[model samples]
Target: MQAVDHVTLATNNGAIGGGEVMLLRIAEALRELSVEVTVVAPATPGGVAEAAKKAGFETVQLHVKNRLSWMWQLRRWDAKHRKGVLWCNGLVPATATWGHRDRIVHLHQHPDGLHRVLSALSRVGAVATLVPSAHMLRSVPGARVMPNWTALMPRSERSPGPDAPFTVGFLGRLGPDKGVHVLAQAMRLLDEQDPGRYRLALAGEPVFVAKSKVEQVEQALAEVDALVDRVGWVRPSEFFDTIDLLVVPSVWEEPFGLVAAEAMSAQVPVVVSDAGALPEIVGSETGMVTPKGDAPALAEKIARIASGNEGVDVAVQHARWAENYSPTAGVVRVRELLDTLGA
Candidate 1:
């Protein structure tokens, strides 16, 4: 097949969330293959556009009045520049590029209600529909599964030694749905059983959420404040260096557990709740899984690991990450998918 001269990756969100991160990573991978790539996102706040530019990719910032404005702006943009594949990174972008024959609609989350309708609408006349996991494929029928992955983190020189504190860490947004509150509850349970035996470290800020939800998360964190260390908005690689284990106790059905993959890449053991694609990503051998929103079950799993009752081989987790969630593997799959589309 002949190589496509250029690919335009368009994002629905102005903010740099998991989907935007995936978009940038794919752009990097495609660029490595000598393919010309461009990123298009909203100008206001310009989070995705700015990050794309910082990463050395060409970027176009559309003057969107609001979310709805992107639909018309993207349509106008695509009408003028339809030379190569239009990769819609989410529902919004997919809607914007609707009915374009060279478009690929990629949905990073499970759809419901109106979003389900939008999901179907976004795929009309597209070359293909892509999702991050097999579980997500069930939600978006006929969509191809392309598992998410993370770049390998550099090893920390100040790695936790045997004498270091047994730290339990949480990453991602500080929201109840992401289950920061659930992790906080689990930490409280652990503290009740054996006070000062474990330390809870938290990274990330509350984002794209209501003020009430932020307050709810704060109230939950308050319950475990004495045992918590707030490490606000740091790189996952840096955050992983200070912790021995990572817990992703999300209450919602996550499309894919990117934090779990990042932790495993850092060679840290993980404990995930069986929500959405989390259990599917962690599998049975590499990490422990508990019922979603069950603080007691999560506490038990943490206690087992802390007290040496649960044998978690970090090397095995690292190997699993390398085989499945590594950037190399994800890039290869994306390359094959694009090849099939002749893009």
Candidate 2:
């Protein structure tokens, strides 16, 4: 509806990840600003396309078997019929449409190895390149920062009681990269020193993880199985309701910590490892931080958060800080990006 006339947003994967969540959020933001938004995604699994259509956007469902097929199909399809701004929402689509005109490349995670090679080629002939955090911008120096947002969560006063076990929540994939194994070790240490002092509300499953690593995590948690409530995948709102605090202990460099931000928005205390943007999301003033993969340090942080008073103070500052990453803030960011391109 603006100067660009139309905007076609493409997805990186058929299965939704943090990137897809951002893709959907930005699509809504685009529509709110009166931009014509059409989502391009693979037909199967169909998470991204379905969510977009449900939110009242036109969807171009590509008939494809795997990511490779989707890339080739989308690349061939766009060359013939593409118009207006083609917002390539991930490296897959960005590389697919490389050398094409008026393209915006958005990379959701830090590129490594083969992806680093592809990302270099993917940015050619694009209008702009975007990553989710300033932490990401360090590695991806040329890209602009577009922090991911959550639908502003309703604030709730939640904290562990005087006698109740302090409940810790983890809301990402149950893979080593998320530091789930590290958290399990921390829990074991917590139990060994101060028995029954903590409980973990594990709220994710192993997706896109190796079977060996998945088994490794299971074995790691086996010692404290009674203290863990393995709730599979859950929305942040639902996940936050069940715990006093949320921990994002990623071992790998994360592009953005959306779950940590959502925890802040919900007025729930959060702890993050010093990996990539996790620490950046919750600075010294807003949330807790621990050394990456250090069980003793993580356990000690959990041991320290034992009262409602500590939770109340941290949650208050966190909610205010989180305002910058809310959906409202996201709309403003998107508008600015659109306006810049429009100019």
Candidate 3:
């Protein structure tokens, strides 16, 4: 057996978003494979510390915010806990765990500038590096592509709501880079073409800033032709039930669009940008894909699905998701990687 005595997972677990959920799932999965998992995260808002205790894992909530504090914590970890493997979520923790080069580094984002420099350094020092897509592979040499997975909701719920104002749901953080402006533009375009046919549901929090950021997003929404219902940050369990069609118009090059996979698992059709890993997430046979930042194309596709002119088989879409991103397959792949690491 490989001498992986302990596994430390460092991530920003603020309990406000999906990253925390991903970290928890990964930790649980690793534990099931007989690895001693320890999650070292930022302190959460609620009783998550107690919850982690109930789940039978040790959690160290170091209240480290900025670079200087993080670096101090890293120096401390390096000095004390010198054995075991370290798997970090993103740049901050990855660099923090840099002193332990013999372990693996699984990078979640396609970093830029200084972060990119750190990632390259990690690649040179680590045993293996994991990324989510081919687009991300260009940023990190020899990085193995492993798509993100989720505990899927039932597929029957993917169908559009039969008795509502034709709803187009925009789910995900309402940050500037999340392409909320593009979604707003598309809603405007669609409302102009068919005033009574389409309505929008904006779900998730404004991650760009605090109170001012939400006000900015609200002001941006005012420019749109219609008013949208804003449902702030939702749990993964509650996602598919609240929407008809999930539209992800990401402006940036996302390493892996987990929203697409989440929607697909429910057998719902998605309208997403052609940028980054979106096309790979929502395969052509399953959902409608348009060019990045093209509001008109987004509107056109939304109109096609809303009007039922383009007969979208949501069941077929769910089948495509089942074929590829099932939790069973993901665990199997992870186990194989573990074996390879041992060998």
Clashes of each: 0, 0, 0
lDDT for each of the candidates? 0.87, 0.85, 0.72
Predicted candidate 1 versus true structure: per-residue lDDT over 253-272, tens digit per residue: 88999999998898888989
Q: Which lDDT tens digits does candidate 2 get at residues 109-148?
A: 8888999989989999999999988999877888999888
TM-score of 1: 0.94
- The weakest ten consecutive residues by lDDT in model 2 span 306-315
Model 1 worst lDDT window (10 residues): 155-164
TM-score of each: 0.94, 0.94, 0.87
User: How does model 3 score by TM-score?
Assistant: 0.87
Report the Cα lDDT for residue 177, model 1. Answer: 95
Superposition error at 152 for model 3 (Å) = 1.4
Tens digit per residue, CA lDDT, model 3, 55-90 = 888877666666568656754775587446676666
Report how far residue 105 has shifted in candidate 1, in Å. Answer: 0.4
Give the clashing residue pairs of candidate 3, or none: none
Candidate 2, lDDT over the whole model = 0.85
With candidate 1 superimposed using the best TM-score fit, by how many Å does residue 343's alpha carbon deviate from the native? 10
